[model samples]
Target: MNARTPRLEEVASLAGVSTATVSRFLNNPAMVAQQTAQRVQAAIVETGYLPNLNAGALASNRSRLIAALVPDIAQSIFNDTMEAMIEQLSADGNSVVMSLTGPDNRRLEAQIDAALSRRVDAIILTGIVSDLETRKRLKSQSATVIETWGLPEDPIDVAVGFSHAAVGREMARFLHGRGYRRPHLVVPRSGRSQARASSFAEHWMADGGEQPSILEVNIPSHFGQGRLAFRGLTDLEHRPDVVVCGSDWIAQGLLVEAQAAGVRVPDQLAVTGFGNLRLAGDMRPTITSVDIDGARIASEVHRILRARAAGEVLPSSLVDVGFRIIARESA
Candidate 1:
């Protein structure tokens, strides 16, 4: 019973299973039957043989792991945001797990189902859920569901993020203030990006500007696509004087494309991007972007989990960590 010497047999005896079975249940949980897993858990409670997650997760019950569902990990802004989120969660004694979603709708659905089967403690989803089936599956899991990056009218559970629609409105006003009448919205075809793109179009027209012309492309924000999407904007019967992008990745590509095309930025075509990544400031012309506070998002998520664990009803269902428009060289 030495404090430093915790024995598995004592825990096994308490859980009412052979030591060998306990070992498999903990190390190779997928091998244990569900009924047997519950028995081990009951014994552990009585004998106070608190086996770490290695055992219990192997048998049955929740995994002390939190899964962060990200569509693209290589995108610089999301990479940083997820890293901070994972760090903050791990510091609070939770294991951080990841499940990458592809561009395909069916693949994303399969990934969601697989994540639910694992029965993790919490689920953190990046972007909005467009697929109704995927959203239903996530809601059915009943875990601490969190949708970050964009806020929706009715989030399934908990959500912490900035409003993409508002981002568009503010950008239009900012452009108008700077004396830019004609604006073009360049965005990736992402779940949340569509919101920003559509809202930006409405807000820009409402602000007394002519109809907003939009250029939409695929995901991951590659430089080549940016060049193509922003191309011909200058030739749009009535050329747009400014461009707003879904993310800095798209903006970066737009900037590169504009430069290669011999168009001077800000002076010729002002560009604004979302998810103010570090590289934004370092870009040659220095991209002007909306700063979505990843650090604040991490802090708020941790605060919510702590409050929930203490049996307190979460006070903030919609947490706006806030966003800021950085006035840089590009815009």
Candidate 2:
């Protein structure tokens, strides 16, 4: 006959404690005395007793699981924020599950449903939800939801992110102040990027400047798309003096293509990027970009989620992790 699995009651009996005390120790060791904790640990080791988390979850109605949704992690733009969130959540005795929903609303909706079915404690989304069905489904669910990256005017539950429009205005001001006449924007074909581009154009045009040249590519863009954008921009009748890219990858591509085409950066044409990636500084002519502190955003998100889980009254449900304009030689 197979040996029966040691139960929590058996561990408590061996450790000279009540079953409730053993369960408390398993859930939160700090709540138990040091001597009692040591004894329980020893009993667990001796009896090889493993806590049945599923059984505990069933009793408490808490899965202690978090699900995070991202558009695409291929470029690893949100890796720092994700890592920090996972680390902090793990410290709180929770596990994080990630899903790549890309840019499709259907895929995102499916993932959201999957997470809900698993009874996740919370759901972390990369950006604002535009799909009405997905938004409705999220709102109807009981799980805590947090939207990151860009602040949505109407958040599902809680929103923690920076303003993309603010980023655009700041970048425009920075470049215009640097004496750039013609400004052009190369961005991804997404609502967030388009919103930023609009803000930038409005800011530039409001100051008696010419209408900025704007171009966009499909989502999940790469360095190659940046090269294509640069080619298209240069071929235009009125070539831009400074170009702002949606992401650093695109700006890097622009730089590489410019070097190949004998275009002098910041001399013949100034260039800038967003996200403030590592390669932005390593390039021959470093790229100027916006620095959105992903780690700080993650910290704030974890704090809100943890507080809500603890039934703490929060001062506000919205948090804005601001951005900074990093100046470099590229612009």
Candidate 3:
């Protein structure tokens, strides 16, 4: 309790243990003897020492702290992926933490900066960071920088994501092959949607299909937007026979809207979505779209970190978890 004493060091001294031993006890409790750990804990409580964990991590050269940063937690796709990764990674040995960066902001860069300041063991970032300074800082820190959700041209370290371009190209080919001449696109103005929407438009035009109408909406909230787009699309001079969405929830809303108007799916207005979430198949007619396997994404990210920690050289910068075109009654 001395005013001049260092926090964790004071507690360690009070427990008759070296600072390194106390650090190990905090990072890996299994390495410390029960009696010694009890003594350290008692000393910590008596001295009111919370331990400068960041300083301890810097001195040890390993934090054993893994952080996953998401652009927005409100998005279900990321919610599922992060949930799976956290549960699985925590089960193995690492201490996993989360940072919810507001959707489509530079918050990811700031969070990554903070993580590097503490020298976290691993950092999994969802979505792309476009800043050059940020990339340089990331490379300098050289922490296990993993880009998830959105694939980057040059990953800071490793990447795990489905190709939005491929998904778009495939959707165009699928609906066009089925003789749906008019397939309009609905996507959010953020994240992967921009890529998906732009690629879909490009590929659809290149495939000799008409320059289909495009509508942008707030993503991860696509269901309600889909409902609104449904009426908008149907009222067009030449109504779209098919609708491709940035997410399954969006497509589901379109289907629900069509049904209420007694419009038969596929027969009248076809619907398709991306992400192929768990509930996609449980819908009345089962949503048909590109399936991005969330579980697989989680596992790959885990392996990347574990492999690096094992001192194994990873041969690839980006690992593609390919998507499948799941055809259902919708399209």
Q: Each model's C-alpha lDDT?
A: 0.77, 0.87, 0.81
Instruction: Tell me the lDDT of candidate 3.
Output: 0.81
Report the C-alpha displacement of residue 43, candidate 1, in angstroms. 26
Q: Tens-digit lDDT track for model 3 on 1-331?
A: 7576557778888999999888777765656898998898788789877766567567767677898887676646777888889987775557788987776664776787678776688889887667788777787775788888767889887889877877778888877798889888887877578788788889889989878888888644657887898988856778888888878888888889989999998898889888787667988788897877888899999888778867799999998887789998888
Cα lDDT of candidate 2 equals 0.87
Q: Report the C-alpha lDDT of model 1 over 213-272, residue by residue, as the tens digit.
A: 777787767667667767767578777788887778778888998888889988988888
| lDDT of model 1, residue 142 | 62
TM-score, one value per model: 0.80, 0.91, 0.81
Candidate 1: residue 70 Cα off by (Å): 0.6
Which whole-number lDDT from 0 to 100 does residue 146 have in model 2? Answer: 93
Angstrom error at residue 104, model 3? 1.6
Scored against the true structure, residue 66 in model 2 reaches a CA lDDT of 94
Give the count of colliding residue pairs in each prediction: 4, 0, 0
What TM-score does prediction 3 earn? Answer: 0.81
Error of 3 at 240 (Å): 0.4
Question: Which is better, 1 or 3, measured by lDDT?
Answer: 3
